[model samples]
Target: MVQERLARRRYGSEVGQWSGWASWSACSRSCGGGVRTQTRLCLEKVAKDNGTDSGDQPPSRAETGRRRLRPIQCVGSDKRFHMCNEEDCPPEAGDFRAEQCASFNEKPYKDRLYRWRPHYSTKRPCSLTCGPENASFYVTLRRRVIDGTRCSPDGGTDRADHVCAAGHCKHIGCDGVVGSPRVRDACGVCGGDNSTCHLVSGIFTEPHLREGYQLVLQIPAGACSIRIEEVVPTRNYLALRAGNKEFIVNGAWNIDNSGQYQGAGATFMYRRQTDTQGETLAATGPITEPVDIFLLYRQMNRGIKYEYVIKRNASLSSVLPRLPNDLQSLPPAPPPALPALPQLPARPSVVPRPTGHRNAVPAPGVARPPHTAPRLPATPAGAGQRRGGVLA
Candidate 1:
């Protein structure tokens, strides 16, 4: 069989070349199991189809049908994904998409200029331009026809209903504080644009008054959720829910010392970490869904002021409770004191076995008793001598 195979190879049955793999594409993200892709070509098939040895491109549709479908299994899939860059967030500062959303804009729409805030929530739609500051002058819709609806009066658009009848709706996130940045595409780009993220901050009160509200925050990434870093030093009581889990934070300095009127009631603030000497802790979440952070507006009226950070594709298991690398510095605690050993009863000294000398040696620090030999009775000797004389 080996010889036949060698003969076939000599006859050029086995081509000298096979397709090689392509270079890997860039990683999809900085962390959280982002992916990269690469591919290989079926060089033999490409050569047979194009009458060329080099495999540069795929076979055309016509060419594929012209040849028998099962001519050969020469082609491989064009792409594959591999997870990479799954590292924890650095302890130091980095990009803050949340902060970028806290911007303001005054965009012109027709005769009126709309005061535009950063869009945070995903529930809103984007607007079109209308510039006609001059008489008989006006702006027009970028999409004169959207979803089969006309952008103009004759086009019969559903702009009044906030629907994209005239064209496909545009979901944008830029300088918007109310839009959900979490509604991004696979590339993490917001609103089909390179728009950055906005920070979701608000004061949640008990009975949402005209000015009060229940704070709702979107996670930084769908796979990785939000990280709420406490900004203020004071205690604040809060009840928040993400997915099926619920969380509560009572701002009282101490649980035993807290009262209804004492400290952080329903409302608090998310200040910077440098504002207090105590460690400004954070509430981490791998929330797969949106998080509702609010209070029962009726229990308390004041709102809690807070800020947050974004976490994407995070390693929930590998991350320590504290900041990175801080766990290693913790000192090893001393072992508990051991109970004293019990005393033993006194016993006779154990004498060492006799050495080559006449006497045995005593244990160190032990004294020995005096040694003596047994004596015979003098009467026995006198009796024996008298008996002998009598016999004579």
Candidate 2:
């Protein structure tokens, strides 16, 4: 009983303790989600160096009662921040870039009155392109985008959309005409009757064209469609679009992949047959007008020899124009001119109230003379009677 009592008493006086965290702080923001915090000041308990009992001494003091401030071991970083400010904005108020561009000036840029272009990002090409009247080395170009106009990318003048790219044109044959110097299709070719044409098939390689890539082949009026095959190399691809329908021809296999596909014209299907080169595809029964052919290739002036031919008496006519897509999808107009500054309902002019001040000060040069009393009749020395202020 003595041993049990001593053991129970030894452990009775002390226990470890810690405090719970305080309540969380209010949310940082109202509309959008934000951050809050809850934290606790960690208090540490340690045995005193003086070997004093904590039960007898206060938590801060040891046996001597001197305050011992122990460096904190549990100093914690608990503060945090997060996203906020999600109030709904007006529909048209969000696009700051457009507003910046649309900002106006009464006078801007070289003293021009109404600048059609934007104050920034105005470097875009404007003009049509054409080929030389004759095959001279000369090339003419319209002026570049205005100087100091920001390039589209804003870094520098590279691959800029609004600025003029070096315009290119396909080589019009010696006989074929581009835009100017209109002459008859000399060989009476594409639009010509079959009298001048035969089953001519060979590598017809022409080096140049005018302005952009367009090749007009004269198919007879009755023939609806035709097929072109690649002879030498493989994987020469071309796309043909009529009305809204489009088809691709992998000329390597000489497949008229387009002739079988749905077109705006009548459907025609043909199979491939070896014709010493690769394969042959024939387009039948869709021709209503002369077929316009365009070859799709890059590094245009690199002068790669392309081996292909139009078989059915195709003649070199004029090259049609390849127009570029609009550079910027501009707003229909300039946001209605910012609503005309609201015409501010003019008010009648107001009469200003006079400042409170006395008017007693006489104007300069005016003066008041002293008033003299009416002459009083002399009165007898002792009588002292007065009527109208005369001395009695």
Candidate 3:
């Protein structure tokens, strides 16, 4: 029997392992669903037993007893097993639990994207429109409250109105008004304590549409000429000429609030006239000398309002004569003899009146009057003897 069993084993080896192949094919055909299900169940059982899933690295024997298993998907071209998709994975795999997705998750790279353009709205409607040709421009003038009380035109106390036409044109939405040029104040022109000159303050001229105009400010007393150092305008160029000299002032007009121009401080120079040139037909005429005058000018809407103050040198007193005779010598005086002095009689010597009171009377030793008088009984008979004898 031993000899027969040895011979049978030798025969099976020589049959090309047919039994192994047959067993594999039979298992595949007979247990297709059962084997796959069994294999998945066995993997899960092994993960639970070892504390690891097919997607995760196998836990150490010591940790396997305390850990749990997680699921994972196949990755990489080689189809090698890897840890599950969790924080413990290699950094190159990225984190799936982050709020913002990684750059790779977004579509259309930055270089391929386009930017949006901005849009603008049209301007708002204006409340006012263009005014007539003769209308004066109004400006809304505003100044921050600084050190002093509010200004005119409803500035101070909320009721006082100190605004001028020139300053009103620049105000917002003011279309300007049609009116005569009005003078704001006399002190605005004359630099003195007394602004008594009515001419100093008034609308000198009407506002016109002309580009260039001339206005003369008459000189007041106590000044010889007007001194003008500056001319400020809101939107125009100005030129000034006095005698043989001329000057130019550059300025601009603002229309955001009102449509007029106004300036605070400005000056102009003028000279008073010295002599007049009377008509003379002679070939050689008398020399003409220019007089000096002083003037002041203020820039306003439409035109410049002028205020003139004549400047005279205090040293000019030298040219005036000191004595009346010298002044009279220049011209003849009225003829008449000096009025004669009225004759007066000599005054009587003043005599003291005798006092009737005894205390005021002269003393008794001073003098006494004679008591007897001569007799005239024989005057008739004595007339015959008067030729021969002198009366005793």
Candidate 4:
């Protein structure tokens, strides 16, 4: 590879030829697989001017316009990416995309300032699109990301093996060669035989007893080329949890749509094939941490098949330690606590009412007023007899 790079550097340097490649730019990240880039120029002239060799000094922009020569396009790519700083970043260092978004934090946009966050989009893989935290809309902050950034670090991209080169997604291979055909085998070795690692696979057939989520299996740290798939579709879901017991996908009974999730120091591609009612989880990894696999058993489980590559000397027991009997089942959720009933003050007992008014008695603390009878009006003698003829 070094020799090929050196040869390309020398290819077009004879006067009026392509210029040697410029020094590579700084890496896009300090760690965690960032990119660096270098560029070359096409110096071949487009037109014969001043009766001199057209190659002798490529025409200046003004001269090219005057000559009206067809615009010269280079025969090959002028820019290329170099994968660099592949060492993993410390856990506390945070994410690279977030760092890019933070570059615009507190900066004015449309006369306003917002706490920006990285907005992922596979369509514009190399563009820096960001939005205010918790916002539904995003703004394309830059036409392209800094060269060397992964084309789509979070995955779900058609060009998973590409990176940004001069604002464009360009192919890169496991061998670090642009447009190289080399690919990693199932063992996750760039060019080694599949024999380098041992494949561990099993079909989990544990009956899901009264389910929400049930422990199915665990993939240990340092696992690579991990794949988990439902053997039969039952509208069931595959759930993943990190070593810390933090849910990675389909946790809390909330069904997540198909997408990439970050956990265990790797990106997991979780897909729900609605057409087939199938669910799958995959990752290309030597995962930095162990991950637990679970099944959301909405119905009777058919089976879940899982496979991953581990070091040749590693045993299945060591890589996938069995959970204790108590943990084999989903941890029971504490039932919602019932609120306490408020206490009421006691009421004084009421004395029985006297059976009759004769039994009623007045206490010494009260004095009763004397009772009086209602008065009646006197009637007139003539008014007592009927004045009508029938009454008389």
Q: Compare the candidates by TM-score and give the number of the best one.
A: 4
Candidate 2 C-alpha lDDT tens digits along 308-335? 1223332222111111120111122221
Model 4 pairs in collision: 35-148
Give the per-residue Cα lDDT of candidate 2 at 256.
51
Each model's lDDT:
0.31, 0.30, 0.22, 0.65
TM-score of model 2 (CA atoms): 0.20
Query: Estimated TM-score per prediction?
Result: 0.21, 0.20, 0.15, 0.52
Q: Candidates sorted by TM-score, descending order?
A: 4, 1, 2, 3
lDDT of 2 at 75: 28
Please write out the lDDT profile of model 1 over residues 50-69, one tens digit for every residue. 23454677668886575444
lDDT of 3 by residue, 142-182 (tens): 22111111122212233222221221211111111112233
Which parts of model 1 are misplaced by more than 4 Å?
1-79, 82-199, 203-230, 235-239, 243-245, 248-304, 307-392
Q: In candidate 4, what are the lDDT values of residues 1-392, reduced to their tens digit?
A: 45434534554322233578999889877887777778898674445432245676766889657534543334456777678887878989876777888999868999988988888777887799888977789999988877656666543366677777667777778888655667777766787778777766656644334556777666778789899887555556788999887899988777788888888988899997454446899998878888888877655555566778876542324444233231555676632322222332332333355442212122234232221111112323453322211122
Q: Model 3 segments beyond 4 Å from truth?
A: 1-199, 213-233, 248-303, 310-392
Top model by lDDT, which number?
Answer: 4
